[model samples]
Target: MNKTILSLTGAVLFATGAVVAQTMAQSTSESTVAPQEADAASVARGAKAWTNHCSRCHNLRSPSELNAELWDVSVQHMRVRANLPGAVADDIKAFLMSSATSTGVQYSTPGQGGASVASFAHLSPGDPLHGKEIYSQTCIACHGADGKGTISGVPDLTAAKGRLTKTDEVVLTNIIKGYQSEGSLMAMPPMGGNPDLTEQDIADVLAYLRKEYDIAPGTE
Candidate 1:
C-alpha cells in the first residue's frame, strides 16, 4: 500500500510539472515552428548550436519561456539581430518546440559542461547596442573599434569567435578575473580598469562583439 501510494504521488507531481510547463509554453510569446518540421537529429544539432552560440551570451534558457509562436518571433529577432543562417535558425526552432513541454520527460541543452569560453553573469543579459557604446569607451582602446586590436599583444576580438574555446561562464572570469598577457608585457586590469562598469555593461559589450563580429559559437 505504501509503495502504491508513493508511485501515485510521483505520478501526480510529474503530471503537475508537465501541466505547468505546457501552460507556460502556451502563454509564451516565442513563435513556434510547425510540429512536423521538428526531428531528433535537427534538435540535437540545435542543442549543440545553442550550447556553442547562445550560451555564449546567456544561460540555457528554459524551453518553456515561450509558446511556439513567441519562439518564432524570438528566433526571428535573433536571426536578424545576430545574423543566424537560415538552416541554423530552423534547427534551433525545431529543438525548442520539441523540448518545450514533452510529457514524462525533461531536457537540458546538451554539451554545456565543458564551456570553451569563460562565463559570467555580465554577459548573460548583454544588450548589443548598449554594449557597443561600452566597448567604444572601455574596450576600444585595446581591442580596436573594428576588433582588430593592436595585433601583437591585445587579442583580436573579431577573430576570437572563430577560435573561442571558453564558455561564456568561463569567459566571464576572463573579463571579471582579468589577465596578464603571456610573454607580452601587456597587462589588462581586472574589470578593464573600471570598477563602475556593471555586469550589464560587460554583457552588452559581449553582445555587441557577438553580433557585430558575427561570432558564431565555434566547434571548439
Candidate 2:
C-alpha cells in the first residue's frame, strides 16, 4: 500500500510539472503575439482614419511643431474644425498621439540648438493656446507632438541647446521667413506653407514653446 501511494505521488508531481511548462509556453507565445497584433491593428485603423477624416482639410504635417499639451488642445479644436464626432475625434487624437514620434510630455530643457525662450522678448507674453492651433496645422507630422522631429536627420527641438540662447526676435524671424539647414533638402517651409498664419499666430506659438519648455524669462 505504501508503494502504491508513493507511485501516485510521483505521477502527480510529473503531471503538475507538465502543466506548468505548458502554461509558461502559452504565456510566452501570447506575450509576444499580442503586441504585434495590436500594433498591426492600430496601424491599419490609424491609416484608414487619417485618410478618411484628416486628409481632406489638412496636409500631413510634422508632429514636433507643438508639444503634447498644445496637441491636445489642437486636436480638440480640430474635432470641431473637421466636423468629426466626439468619439471619433478622440480616437483620432489617440492614434496620432500614439503613433506620431513626438514625446507626449512637454520638456523643461532646451533642445540641441542651445536656444531657449529667454532670448525672445516677444515670446514672453505669447499664448500657448493659439500656438497649439498653428502648430497642429503646420508642424505636427515631422516635428512630432513634443517638438521632437521624427525624421532621422531632422533636429529635435526639445534636445536643442542653442534654442536656449535665441532671442524672441530670432525665433520670430525664423518662423516668418523659414529656415534651411545645410544638407537638409527640405527647408522649414514658410509658416509650414500656410500663408494664412498671422504674425500674432507665430508669436503665440513661440510663447507656448517658451512656457512648455520652461525657458526662463529674459531680464529687461
Candidate 3:
C-alpha cells in the first residue's frame, strides 16, 4: 500500500511538470508573435492615415532626416493638426517612426546629385487659384490671407525666407511631416484640416506661394 501511494504521487508530479512546460512554451511564442503582428497592423493603418490626411498637406520623404525625438514632437502636434482621434494618431506615430527614422540614420532625398533637395516636382500641379480658396477656407485663420500668420508666434508665410530657400522637397516634406517651431505653442497642423485637399493641392499652394510671395526655391 505504501509503494502504490508513492507511485501515484510521482506520476501526478511528472504530469504537472509537463503541463507547465507546454504552457511556458506557448506563452513565449505568443509574446514573440504579438509584437510583430501589432507592428504590421500599425504600419497598414498608418499608411492609410497618411494617404487620407497627410498627403494633402505634404509629400512623403525619407524618414531618416528626422530623429525619433523630432518625430515624437511632430506627431503630437499633427494629432491636433489633422484632428485625429487619440487612438488613430498614436498608431500613425508608431508607423512613421518604425519605418522612417527608428534607426537614427539620416536619409537622402531624390535628385540634385545626392544633395538632398526637397521638392514636390514628383507630384502634379494643383490649381493655385483653388488652393488659394482652400487656404482661405481652412488655413487663413492661422496662416492669414497673405500666407503670413496673424497670430503672434506663427510663421510668416509671406516671408518664409529660410523655409522657401529650402528645397521644394524640404518644404513639401515639412508640410507632410509637420513640426514644432522653437518657442512656439502652436505647431503647423497637417493640411490645416482640409481633408478634401490632395497631393496636387499642396503642390499648387506651394507654387502660388513661391510665385506670389517671391519665395525662391533652393538649388542643390
Question: Candidate 3, after superposition: displacement of residue 95 in Å?
Answer: 23
Encode model 3's per-residue lDDT on 20-91: one tens digit a residue: 989899886877575433254454455446445665576544344465467667878988987889667766
Candidate order, TM-score descending: 3, 2, 1
Model 1 residue runs over 4 Å out of place are 1-124, 160-165, 218-220
TM-score for all models, in order of appearance: 0.41, 0.42, 0.44
Cα-based lDDT at residue 16, candidate 1? 97
| Model 2 per-residue lDDT tens digits across residues 11-73 | 999999999999899886777575322242343344345446765765554445555456557
- List runs of model 3 lying over 4 Å from the truth: 1-121, 160-162
Taking all chains together, the TM-score of candidate 3 against the true structure is 0.44
At residue 2, candidate 1 shows an lDDT of 100
lDDT (tens digit, per residue) of candidate 1 on 1-220 = 9999999999999999999989878655354443446564566455445445665565556455566678777877877776889678877776565544423121221135421334353335778899898777656645666778633456666665432344454444455545443354443434553445666677677777778977754442
Give the lDDT of residue 184 in candidate 2.
51
Better of 2 and 3 by TM-score: 3
